[model samples]
Target: MTLFELTNSLKRTITESSYGQSEKHKLLQSEYVSHRELVQFYQACNPTPTLLSLIRQTKLHLPKYKTYKQTKTKEFLKMMEKLRLEAQEAEYRKLINPDPEHTTLYDTSNQEYVSPVQAHKELKNQLTTIVNVFISVGSVSYAVWYWTASSWGLRDSYRVLLTVFFGLLVLVAEVVVYMGYLNKIEEARAKESKKKEVKKVIKTYDLTLDNLTAEKL
Candidate 1:
């Protein structure tokens, strides 16, 4: 049978078989599943034929759209953790009593609140776009390469070697670009964080100075 026919038959057979939702499926969706499975069947290379079979069976159930729920959860956790730490810091600041102890002066200026989490969130949005694009393009390319390589003798030892090398090169380039984007995002977040810190310090300094001046009167 032609590869297309073979693939279709396999897909149809698996879809007709019994499959049900399970915790494992949720985990797979959250971490392991990728578009390459749709294009190249690389997921079948897994040592667990049973799991591979399930993957094929559940292909029809895979969502057409990408969801970054896991990433959002991670960001939310980070934000909450930061907020907790900031609260503790605020408590410590109050304890230290920056205003002169000799005077009954109190500086009640509100602290400037800046959230670096928003920057992280925006970065995640951009990264999600990049990831979707990469997966879509990579899957399509792999499908085309796999289909034509052998037919054109490109899958022969010498040619296959070159094919593999070129594929690896593309993979490396994609990884580098992905990492570069992440680093740029991190730098942007760092800059925003620095600004927040500077502003926070300035506010504290101004309040302290104002309080001290009032005490001399």
Candidate 2:
């Protein structure tokens, strides 16, 4: 059979078989059967068989299968144990502090958790730095322009008066733009906070150690 036909036939057989109900079978169907390497291996078979029969027949011939089974079994056990411990700790925390107030916020953009105080301090420092840079650059540029204009026959007094007016205009414009930027930041933060709140509803799963032997296949 062609590779496409063979793949479809194998998938159909797997779905109908009693083994299809197994987690191992599910993993195989999802991650392994369609893989190029496995497909190539299947193609090489003189008369291709179902994956289960192929594995059962070739288990002794492929030493890597035994090694893979052992490694995956250990890894699976470790992961399950870690999950169990985390679940237990969560349960204990819930019992100890039934209605714990969450002051910490998750910054989804940065993918970090921070307390309100820390977040405020960070934002304040960032804004201060930005304002300082803008003021320094504006002051230097205005000084250069004033000096150049004065050299080109503009009166010093007139330049000084113009500087005051220009500075005020720039300041007002900056304030308007900065306020709009702050509003946008606030809106984005509110949306992210809502997303984080929704995500806080954790979904618990019933995890079990499925047979790792099929994984080796």
Candidate 3:
């Protein structure tokens, strides 16, 4: 299949999958396309564009996106657990101090609250853009360093060997930077999840007056 066709096919197949309400479904969005799978698929083609070039054209970052998604999923689950516990604690406190005036001590519903997640959500798009910029910056810096330093003051044989060594170093560093960037994305996602969880815990439950009156009746 053609490059675009192949890429789209992969995306369409995965995105259209009926993964139900599981976190897997959320992680399977098109943005989270896997780079390794793309590379392997393209490599199998008789004539395909360079992997990097294709990625540049498509601007799909599976690795970073996957990390971001997985982090959010993990934090979502963790936050849910914490919120559940807090909910139970609030209930326990409510039972202990049944006075209506004391309910605010545990629930804190009196003041206006802005969710940290909602407040900082705009930063997520910009953050991902910054990470994508790093891919280019890392590559260009490696090229400049490789050619300039490798060509300076060494014998031809030594220069060649140094080039290989430096080349490997650059490659390793690039990988490290990419990995670190993904981790950063993941952390950002988790932070947002935590903020949402906090909001959920604080404003989560509201006992309606009608329900209680009906129960009494």
Q: Which candidate is the best by TM-score?
A: 2
Candidate numbers, best TM-score first, in rank order: 2, 1, 3
Across residues 1-217, which tens digit of lDDT does each residue of candidate 1 receive?
1112224445444334343335224323442334443333434333235555544534343335877665568888999999999999987876664533333355433332335896788688878867876675567556656766756645456555555566667677777876898799778866765663222344434468878889898
Overall lDDT per candidate, in order of appearance: 0.55, 0.57, 0.56
Error of 2 at 165 (Å): 1.4
For candidate 3, lDDT tens digit of each residue in 87-186? 9998896675454343444655432345779558747755776576566556655665566566675465665665556656666776687679879977
| Clashing residue pairs, backbone N/CA/C < 3 A, model 2 | none
Give the alpha carbon lDDT tens digit for every residue of 31-83 in model 2. Answer: 23334434444444423455455443321221235444445688889999999
Q: Against the true structure, whose lDDT is highest?
A: 2
Q: Which portions of model 2 miss their true places by more than 4 Å? A: 1-117, 120-141, 148-151, 196-217
Candidate 1: residue 72 lDDT (0-100): 62
Off by over 4 Å in 1: 1-155, 196-217
Better of 1 and 3 by TM-score: 1
Worst 10 residues of 3 by lDDT: 1-10
* Cand. 2 Cα-lDDT: 0.57
